[model samples]
Target: MPLLNGDEEISGVLRKYRNIAVVGISDKPDRDSYRVASYLREHGYSIIPVNPTLKEWNGIRAYPSLSSIPGDLKVEVVDIFRKPEAVTEVVREGLQLKPRVFWMQEGVVNREAADLAVQNGVDVVMDRCMMKEHRRLLGGK
Candidate 1:
């Protein structure tokens, strides 16, 4: 079955996952990825920033790709901040990391990529704000 957008599922994901790989994260604090990553980290989630252009972001080591993340650090959720067209590549790379979920942030969705994730036994959440969902379902700021 494809990923469900039910509140229960969102809440479950938020409650269960602690490690998040934030793809396309930016150095700019004003960016959504930065804010979301910061919020998640502050809330106790281990945030691994993923961006090819930078070596670090928000003080966390930024990997050039999902495959580059050290083996010791397991990624539970792959939160994508990239455009829809770029999601497939990210999803393909994230699958190698074997994350529990492929999360396409607000305004980003690629049906093909989502289907690929589901086919690999990975849950997918597309076009949703991870931070907003966490705040609403997990009862945090």
Candidate 2:
């Protein structure tokens, strides 16, 4: 199945899932990934920052990768901020984690990755920003 629009389903996912793994999250405040992660954290979602080069950001520990996060963080969403070509790898890794939703950021879409996620029984959202969807649907910033 192809990726779906983040409408009612996304809202439900966001409301139901509180812990999120932010792949490719940047330490720089100027980056959209950082801004979105911050927004999610501010809105009461627990964010696990995934960046290989960073150890910490905004007072939270940053894991080098998804597998590095210890003890079933119970992650519900995997928000990816990497390039389109890199999405397949992240999708493969996310499948191992078994998050409820796999989200590719705005302008990042890979049909193969989305299909792979769907095949693994994970809900997929491509070419969409999680922050925008949250604000539009959940009245969050």
Candidate 3:
């Protein structure tokens, strides 16, 4: 089943959460991950970078994995920028953080991963760009 919810629901999550963990975030400026994370950061959302290849992103410590994020750190959303096949592990590990939402960026979708997240009582959003949603739903930056 498709994991997308109504616009109102998505917007509600966006409005309520300020801390997001961007899994598979990249260091490249041109990458979607970088741009989206940057946009969210600029809009007052705390972006926690979760990329194994990077030691840090924009001066913030980049965790090698979701589980690598410090236990005390608060993550309200797990924004996935990984391939569909990689979503399972991210969702599994992200669950440990107890995030309120599991967001699969545009073009990234996995029914199994979405099901797993939904079954765990977490809101699941598939194939949507966080930057676009924030801009469209709540007005431009």
Candidate 4:
């Protein structure tokens, strides 16, 4: 059976998982990564920033990598914002944490990485905007 599609499925994912770790999150307020992360956080979801350069972002302490996140902290979703070519590496790192979901933001799709995540029993959502989906599914509550 294939994974569910459409707003229902995407909405289900957003509701099911709240601890979202945004990989390649940018510090710039104008960046989509930052905006998405901020939106998710405002919606009562825990936001974990994964960036090598910054020590912190949006008031949350950022980890240099996915693996660097505290062991006790189990991330539910890995929201990737890197380019397509860089997604594979980001997904590889996310695998170490064994997250429940792997979400590649809009315009970012990596078949190899998606397959790998699926093989590891993780739900994959690729080429979709997390913020848009959330608003659409939940009626922007």
Which predicted model would earn the best lDDT? 3
Q: What are the per-residue Cα lDDT tens digits for candidate 2 across 91-130?
A: 9877878888898999998989999999988888888888
Please provide, for model 4 over 1-141, each residue's C-alpha lDDT reduced to its tens digit, 9 standing for 90 to 100.
123356767888899888999999999999999999999898999999999999999788999999899988889999999989998888788888888889989998888988888877888888999999988888665
Candidate 2 to truth, TM: 0.95
Q: What local lDDT does model 1 show for residue 53? A: 99
Tell me how far the alpha carbon of residue 60 in candidate 1 is from the true structure, in angstroms, after superposition.
1.2
Question: How high is the lDDT of residue 122 in model 1?
Answer: 96
Model 3's number of clashes is 0
Q: List the residue pairs that clash in candidate 3.
A: none
| Alpha-carbon RMSD of each model | 0.9, 1.3, 1.6, 1.4
Compared with the true structure, the alpha-carbon lDDT of candidate 1 equals: 0.91
What is the C-alpha local distance difference test score of each model? 0.91, 0.88, 0.92, 0.87
Quick one: best TM-score, which candidate? 1
| Residue 82 miss distance in model 1 (angstroms) | 0.2
Off by over 4 Å in 3: 1-4
**How high is the lDDT of residue 88 in model 3?**
95
